[model samples]
Target: MSSTPSTVLDRFLRYVQIDTQSDPNSTAQPSTEKQKDLSRLLVTELFEMGVLDAHLDEHGYVYATLPANTTKYNVPVICFCSHVDTSPDCSGAGVKPIVHTKWDGSDIVLPDDLSQVLRQSEHPDLTAQIGNDIVTASGATLLGADNKAGVAEIMDAVYFLINNPDIKHGTIKILFTPDEEIGRGTAKVDLEKLGAAFGYTIDGESVGTLEDETFSADAVKITISGVSTHPGFAKGKLENALKIAADVLATLPKDTLSPETTEDMEGFIHPTNIEGILEKVTLGFIIRDFTVAGLHEKETYLKRILENVLTNYPHSTAHFEVIEQYRNMKEVLDQHPQVSDYALEAIRRSGLTAKRRSIRGGTDGSRLSFMGLPCPNIFAGEHAFHSKLEWVSVQDMQKAVEVIVNLCQIWEEKA
Candidate 1:
């Protein structure tokens, strides 16, 4: 709240200790009730900083507003967003964050688990954090810096704007969402109540990077029902569902169109889950691409593979289903060039060279863009997220705060 460098780090430290891991198998809006533990605390902290409108909704969303300090009436309302929940890929419980103050740039061995190590060779991003304070979690859990660093930076920027009223800016909005890790971040957000013309999600990685494009995504499920018979009399009478499903998976292309083999602009269809018995089996997959046509092409290709595999199991019947996920945000951002231009200018004003790039994964902004808010992503300096080796730099977080503060002023100036 004092605009000090420690404010962001302190906030980050406080946030990462909370166990806010979201469950992908849950049916609730947030996918986890523990997510509210962090949301409630955020609201209280915002209220302490003079944000009277700060409140947490029933769906575990935290929303707050900072009134305009400028005389200009044309400044568009801008919102800064981040997610509260950490990924389900790793454990986030009982997190112990350790800050390496003025780090000398060496491999960090997590205290909880001797085997867990953060090496500069594996993560090239550490090469840039030579003299900055680096934060990481104990060996057993993730640090939760994926988006909490963004949350802290936004909080610090809001506090700076509040204390320095002379630095004029337009009305600003703050939104903290839950379940972004499970793809439900924007599922229950009230856009009309938010009422922001343009927005930015402080959820990117690296320093001085802005992302306007993201992968268009979809989920596919294939269920197979096979004829079953007792093992003793199962010579030709038994068509095992598990074996049928395995055949389909094995038939998929192993050298191409996968998460491990794709990079940059390449698309991937990833098999995420498979569960079954002798009579029935369900296979789950996620398809990602930069375009709608690409998504369809991959989906069709996957189905073709499934169909060909089913030819060997005549008695087995299968059902294929596809679920629509968020699309590429660039399709919407292209209509509002000023949204990114102002952000780039703000980053430059903060004394950093801005690099406009595209993310291989989707963010909360991807859906919010189509929801009538042209939101892009800003860097929060998080690396190796959703793992025990997840880390964030204090200097990088402070720079994010400066970028956010500058963005407010830039929007007011351009108005």
Candidate 2:
């Protein structure tokens, strides 16, 4: 039993109206208290869907269990996951979702300071969306489709399954994580307790897109220390940290080389932020690569770049720290081919073609896979994520619910 677009849209709009922007600078587990608002709502919805055990943990993770009803199907329990936090890039508060009925596929201008033309020429997919309602944000705020669409789809699928018990399925677990945008969504995830042999995260972009691979990412923070003296009396004896920081930046391959210049399988070092003075400076960068070997190569190259810069300016003490955020899930998922096969078959059963793709960034699934749960990402029909131009197709979202239902059926059949 698939959910109707009208119903999914209503749920999505209600979820986005809550402000759950995660904080990157915060040391808290969930990062923001407002995230609890959505988590609590999800808990209530799950209980209403007949998942009587639905509850939110102390860390704001909402979980529920639909115990196995079919004795013939003894497949290991499966789970569906999505994050409740929106990016801190914009305000997620007071979000006003605008629903456009029968999209003409023209450029949509929002009341905020953004204009996005779904140029029919640019997106052929927009063609399929003609006569379908699309939900977007007024240029002032991000539409929260990034993961809310995922959340809505998960909720809808659970409710649909609850209403239709004839569908053969095993135990199903549902979870809504918080602070995923900040990269710590799964840090405290109780994997042993989750009890899912494999799961799917409904957070991909395109209708057919299924991402099982992603870049192994790391964040580097470089601190350059130098002797500072009065600029008015400065001479060759004075060493400026700001100048050293500039030299280190210059050592990088090229300033223009970025995500725009890079393509598939191309690794690049992105300088995200920098701030400091003549005495000390701190520069931040994110290094991304599809393979760990390539990641190591890039890391070594960066260290060499810094050493080369240090050679140019003697006596400058440069200290750097790099922390790995997430690893590529491909290698792990590759070993478990069933995970991908189940997802592909599920999408196909939903009447949508399955297209295996790569994630430009990471998802909570990546971390979950590494944590003994082979989790691949499923699409939720949301596009232009994390911006005011974000939009989701009503029909595709309904299809996502079907896909989720199909996934459980496929799993039981295989088992």
Candidate 3:
């Protein structure tokens, strides 16, 4: 193995330049063809790094394995996973990454757009990265640091391990999935082929966060059908579906049970989309909570609101449908507490105070846990994800690489 440190920053810069934005409207597995561009590049880079088995599958998922260098035979195969596609909410094309060398704890205004500023007050994490190199986009596009930072950290860790065979570790699997932002990240994962005992999704924010739990989620779609009549003669005969939908939205508790009002373990009922006319209207909502009971309660409350709103428009008919998205990984991770315990130990070994936290949003790990791999989330330094104001610190990312290296050692030592 080479004694020199891996160039994780360079890898990350190169990855964000590629436009790998995922599309939610697309029915394809990857949701976008451009996602394959990064997937193919990852495969090529993996092969160049001496992982001969590294290849992108038909579904644009990149899978690679690092064979164990140790004499011990019982070490469990641990998988480090991340997604390649950026969120569909923001543009990820022609990303010009700006590096702020030695951040002085000041507001960073994007070069392309001064309106897009990274304020220290808004981002408390910036306080910790005072002297570190901060990376952000040029404001025209999103910096794909969400999972790309995770990908770079994992790649650098693998490269470090490969170059230094002295660091004894068991077989490690690397998985780069697609469409994580659109929520189909692990939909096509072949667990039989992965064959790992446990997994860690290096896809969280900040420096030392080790998230073992995520919100249990469900999608609610409300469709309203109303009688349409000519406006000239529509005094009492017309029941505007748009008016009913508006009333329902206005009745939703804005002071509580909302994404803007909730924090920590609090649940939220968020309306994602609303569209329709006087004849028909549809409302899309995403419900989140830490518990199944909480989810049901929120759904019941939402239905009650809709029912009350429809009472005014007796001629209108409404249909409310709930779709299951994903459950909290805590249900699975609780059964295997060692998965997070080892990660916390690894974080301390990497010289950071490990913070055991839960994600307000779900990761690919959430779905993978239910799929039988039992995965938890690890920090990759991504901050303000899914926006033009996104940023990450080079020092924080390097620390994450150290955490990954330490995790490999911890699992082997414990085994």
Candidate 4:
């Protein structure tokens, strides 16, 4: 009953067919009730596999345990985790997965939309997937591979371990979280009950990547207030707040401080939303940097721009607010080097050259690391995530499952 490539592919395709897009504006724990759709299904499958404790909690998280089959009590408890919710940036409803069996190194034109093409040059990983089975959506919606691929790989790995009891391993924990795409994946996690010494998030891009660092994140809000007056008498008395807000946006550095302009450790001050009227305007921004000092610097620069813009409009005033989101996971991961080292070793045992990388965005692992569970991210073969062109190779997904299995064995052997 070992999991073959077909098992992983089948699970991913089925999971994506269900809509589980999380909501960022929702204040609820799960953000969207539909996320529980996949959560319930995962619990049912886990229970059928003999993991009787598998159940969805009040917060819509699915937690289960795979008891250690080994006599080594000293082996540390390890958890394999992934999120069930997909990103809200794109539509995840009614996904139709298209499988390209035995890719022939040609550009993949999505069926639903010919304009949405997966170019081999844009996706260098496709070079290695030439002969592998690649899965994608129909171009009308995102493939949900960002984390669903991770969910399937984790489930298949559990199935393999349970079916092959001869494989010695430590007590393994399985966690499927909701609202991760909204940045609240572990908000209600009961770490005391989980009791795992360490964990790994199967929520990264590419097959050979093991990410230990993530960008330190912050949220910023700027509000502008302007005088309201009749248009007929507005010659010298009225100052439009909407115009002031536009000025601030226009003043933001185009080449140095934007998501489109920054890359590879360079931080950015990105304006995510702007809404305003003639009298009042609000601007929402997300700030990201690899270091705390860098985050602060970007915030300071942003405020300076707002101040300078308001200087011209004497009657108008502005307010700037900064909210702490999450910090770099490396701050905590550095304290426990073995957590990442074991994963790199496991990747090698799975017959792939390990590549240590840092993500430009944050993950559930980033939040968990600061929440007392030192967790790093492992690759799940996702590429071009949060887009209609997103895709993943079945062969790479199987390799990720192998890494999870090897990681379990390495923990027991080292113990």
RMSD of 2: 2.0
Model 3 over residues 206-293: C-alpha lDDT tens digits?
Answer: 7999999999999999999999999999999999999998999999886999999999999999999999999999999999999999
Clash count of each predicted structure? 0, 2, 2, 0
Question: In model 1, what lDDT does residue 69 have?
Answer: 84
- Against the hidden true structure, what lDDT does model 4 obtain? 0.93
Clashes of 4: 0
What are the lDDT figures for the candidates, one per model?
0.92, 0.86, 0.93, 0.93
lDDT of 2 by residue, 1-415 (tens): 6333235777999999999999999998789999999999888877776789998998889888888777864698999999999999887888989999988777666766645544567656677788888888877788899899999998888777777778889999998999999888997888888888888999998897789999899888889988887878877767888888787777776533367778877878888888988888999999999998888888788888888877766778889798988999998999999999889999998888899988879999999999999999999998878877788998889889889989888888888
- Clashing pairs for model 3 are 1-163, 1-164
Off by over 4 Å in 3: 230-236
- Name the candidate, 2 or 3, with the larger TM-score value: 3
**lDDT (Cα) of model 2:** 0.86
Error of 4 at 360 (Å): 0.5
Model 1 ranges off by over 4 Å: 1-6, 230-237
| Whole-structure CA lDDT of model 1 | 0.92
TM-score of each: 0.95, 0.95, 0.96, 0.96
Error of 2 at 242 (Å): 0.9
Writing each residue's lDDT as its tens digit, candidate 4 over 1-415 gives 2433337888998899999999999998889999999999999999998999998999989999999999988999999999999998899998999999999999999989999999989988888888899999999999999899999999999988988898899999999999988789999999888889999999999889999999999999998999889999898889999999999999987778888987898999999998889999999999999999999999999999999999889999988999999999999999999999999999999889999999999999999999999999999999999999999999999999899999999999999
